[model samples]
Target: MAEILLPLLVLCPLAASLLVFLSAGRMGARAIGTVACAGVGISAVASIILSVMLLSGPVAGGLQVTLWPWMRVAGLSADIAFTLDRISMVMVLVVTIVGLLIHVYAAGYMRDDPGIARFFGCMTLFVAAMLVLVLASDLLCLFIGWEGVGLCSYLLIGFWYDDPANTAAARKAFYMTRMGDVALLCGLLLLACATGSLRIGTVLASVADGRLPASGVNVAAAFILVGALAKSAQIPFQAWLPDAMAGPTPTSALIHAATMVAAGVYLIARVHDLFAMAAPVMALTAVLGALTLLMGACTALVQSDLKRILAWSTISQLGYMFLVLGCGVWQAALFHLMTHAFFKALLFLTAGAVIMRAGHEQDIFRLGGLRRAMPGLTAAFVAGASALAGLPLVTAGFYSKEMILSGVWHVHFGLAREWTLSGHPLWGIALLGAFLTALYIFRCVFIVFCGKAGTRAAGRTSRLMGIPLVCLSVLSLFGGVIEMPDTLPSLHLFSALLNPGTPLSHADEPVWLVLAGALAPLAGLGVAWVLWGRPSPVMREIPGQAGVIRPARTGRGMDVLYDRVFVQPFRLLAWLTRLDIPGHAITGTGRLTRAANAGILGARAGLLEMLAIRATGTARWAGHLPGLFQNGRVRWYAAWIAGGLCAGLAMAVLS
Candidate 1:
């Protein structure tokens, strides 16, 4: 049963889904919902216990449970095993905890929906798949979980399949992520072929001992990066996430908070040893991460749709996590993942609560003064927003953000220099990204929660949905205390959990360096206040005039220009499929069989051409008739048959 617990951690949700599916279209949906949620909750609690037990002891005794040999062939072996280590334990806890909250929230959020059982079933399946992904001990197992989560994402995104937009968004997400999945799969295959092992620990050991070739390492790293960028929605592959907001808000929260997007960070962190071995790969990771961070923050600054803005923000924050990992701050990256799941989940659930109250309206421009109307939700939003802005103290975001900045700072200096090219100047770019993060977060907060209410908020209101908001608000504030690192002194509980590969080179940081890190968030908040503190003519002036739309049409927006430059050419090639074929060409394929009809002049001429070819061939080589089927009307058909008969007669006579 102890070994069974690990498998049960994943199977519970899957079994629950079967029960849910069978119970659909009946009052049994309620019971199914309760069982599914309870099953997941129980798994989450068990996983936490496993994590705590592992963390309290040595690596050998930590949560490593193997059931049976999953495969054995060609000197390769993969076990159907689950390992509960420090990193994955953290991830599963977040996935299950946040997943449960969303489920409860959905109980009220989707109460009136016609497809309640279906939705709950998908949710359970998603949780099960995600648990397997985090728990898998090998790359092949991880990928099964990987693709499983992606499949669930497509289903959830288009849960309302009646809407063309939802279906389109779902397709976009699936296709875009599949591009990454291909790369990831190729990389994993390369790793297996090179080392003859797909186990995580074995791969890390080989990489660290310099047993693998650098070229193979680079190829694998690059392939993995392609998948990470695609899955995490980094630049060039990021457009799908914003469009993905067409799904229910819970789907948005799940994707952004725990499962789909987080998989990229998980992959990188899980395989940090391989990344460290390939110096060029590490540099590429840093550059890509920094670029995605800036791009996402800049886009978030200008977005008006609340969900779309949050969508971009998720990409930006994930970029930050990637940046931390890229700089070789493994613990800091994981810590940020922890805090991010809490606050981002809180923000999204709060957003869901607001949308529920407002009859599905999600435009920030149409929302204001919610602080007075829905105090619980407003407070939760503020708490999450403040954490996002990296405000000091009383927030999990505070600890995580500080640790990430500290990691960046360590990279900029000479500390934590395990990987080559250690002293790159990308840390400055990362700091600028931090500033942008605070600015855009507050920009959304000020616009949606602080001002006067708009038409959308007039009648939409509810009290039952407020509970998750309050619960997540508390988590968002204090969750940082759970995993505090030693480098940051504010909250220091779990500092040892995140040990930098090396210590801080200097015992003390300069006053200005510390001040700059502290001040980045404040500066961002100020910039947000200046832009969105009060609505000005800039908001009202552009829509009616051709001033803005003309440039957008002319491709002034950098993103649009980038799409045209890099992606549109392929789109143009695909556009050829849309050409209007004549109905005759499309529908008259069978008419070709009637070409030898006797009524047509064009068909009759074809018999002479066939006879000439047969005569020419006979003169050369005893009469061969290769073109006997090129018949014209009935005359052509008769000539074709006569030519074949004459050729046969001549051949027989010659013989």
Candidate 2:
């Protein structure tokens, strides 16, 4: 059963999606949704059992799960396989479980939507694609899953196709990430060409065994990082994510946090051996990660839309994941990946609850004191936000983030023999990013739960919604225990789960470094409270100073800078291609061809007349053709030619 169960996870949801499409009009939409959700639920359960079975045994045994041969062409062969080791198992479990919950929540959140059946179909297909992504053993198979998820995201984000803005946002997200995917495709080809194998485990093992060239790894790694950066929404590629809020909340949670966006981090972790060999690429990845964190944090400070803030924060948190990867802490990145999934998914769901109550109003300013009206929802939100802010001792986010920062700091502090600190720029960036994370998170919390409630009372939420929120909140609070040590002096429990066989060494750290890491978030929280907890009369009196306003208060202005920088130039180039170069060349070549082909009858007539005159018995006259061909011959010459023609005709007739 277990052997066949792996393949079922990928096929069942897909078949269900087809069934959903067929049943769309004939059956009740709710009934169709229930069936779709059940399929994902079953797959989720199978995924969990598989994860447990794998982790409980030897790591080698854990990595063995080949469903079948996927493709074979020439020298490159890829198998449709599933590797159930600790990392892949963890990701697979998170994707399926969180995906199923979001599916359930979508049942309520999108009940009134007319495209309910279509929505479920897309969601089911997305889960299926993500399952293949985590389970696949080779790059070719992984890419199929990768592009499949991207397609599903495009479809779901623009689910409300009637809205042009939503459609445009969806297009923007797809195209931008596609640019990165191209680079990644190149990287994969480079790897296959150099190593002669597309199997991830094989490549990693070869690299680790020193059987591969560092130069090959370096170039391939660089290409992979490009894909990772674009997919993860790191820095320059991040603007699309905030704009992605045009999607429904459940779609937002499922795609952004639980599945689609996290593929980048999972990519790097899956290829840790390659990255370890490519030091230059790793360093660049780290730098880009730091930038993503800062950009997301800074942008989130002024966001008013609840989902947008979370979106930016998601990007920022992804940055931390990449930063840890650069520090050679693959396990830490994977841990953060798990914890971030729980908390971020929770935050998005709770935000949906509030927004749902407010009649779909997303501006934080319009929403306040939700805690007073929706106590359970408030507690859930706080728990999730606490984890996001990495608050002390209450959530998994703390342990994971702390571990990452510790790794970053260690690398920045000249711990690595080949690397030296030239003032530790990455460490400083990490601290600033942490402070901003806390500030914006508290701002989000305080704005929504601390002041005055919005127009609608919080009692409007359904039990289905509230129950999921509560479940996520409990997970957010206690999920860390699975990763925490029983005693402080004992080894950190996550160390074993994250790095199964790695050696651990204890070291004394500088007090100031420790203080900076500890106090940064506290300071951010304090700042948020002072500014937003209780607005002062004097502060309110200051006109035109709306720095305290939530980010979306600016509306489309949120993406205006992006349009000016990226979109406008892109549009201009497109216009130039259409109207300037290719357009002109096409027009010009068309005009020339038309001229050469035109007046064919007139040209043929002139040629025939010339031939007739030349063929006549007038070789001597033909020598004087210039005069004969002229229209205005003299009257005497015309009479002489007429008489000569008559004589010749009479002679031929007599003969």
Give the Cα lDDT of each candidate. Answer: 0.76, 0.80
- Candidate 1, which segments miss by more than 4 Å at Cα? 412-425, 456-464, 482-495, 498-506, 534-655
Tens digit per residue, CA lDDT, model 1, 28-71: 54565587778787887777776666667774454767877889
Best model number under TM-score: 2
The parts of candidate 2 lying over 4 Å away from their true place are 209-212, 412-419, 484-491, 503-515, 535-655
Clashes of each: 6, 7
TM-score of each: 0.81, 0.84
The model with the greatest lDDT is 2
Candidate 2 lDDT for residue 590: 97
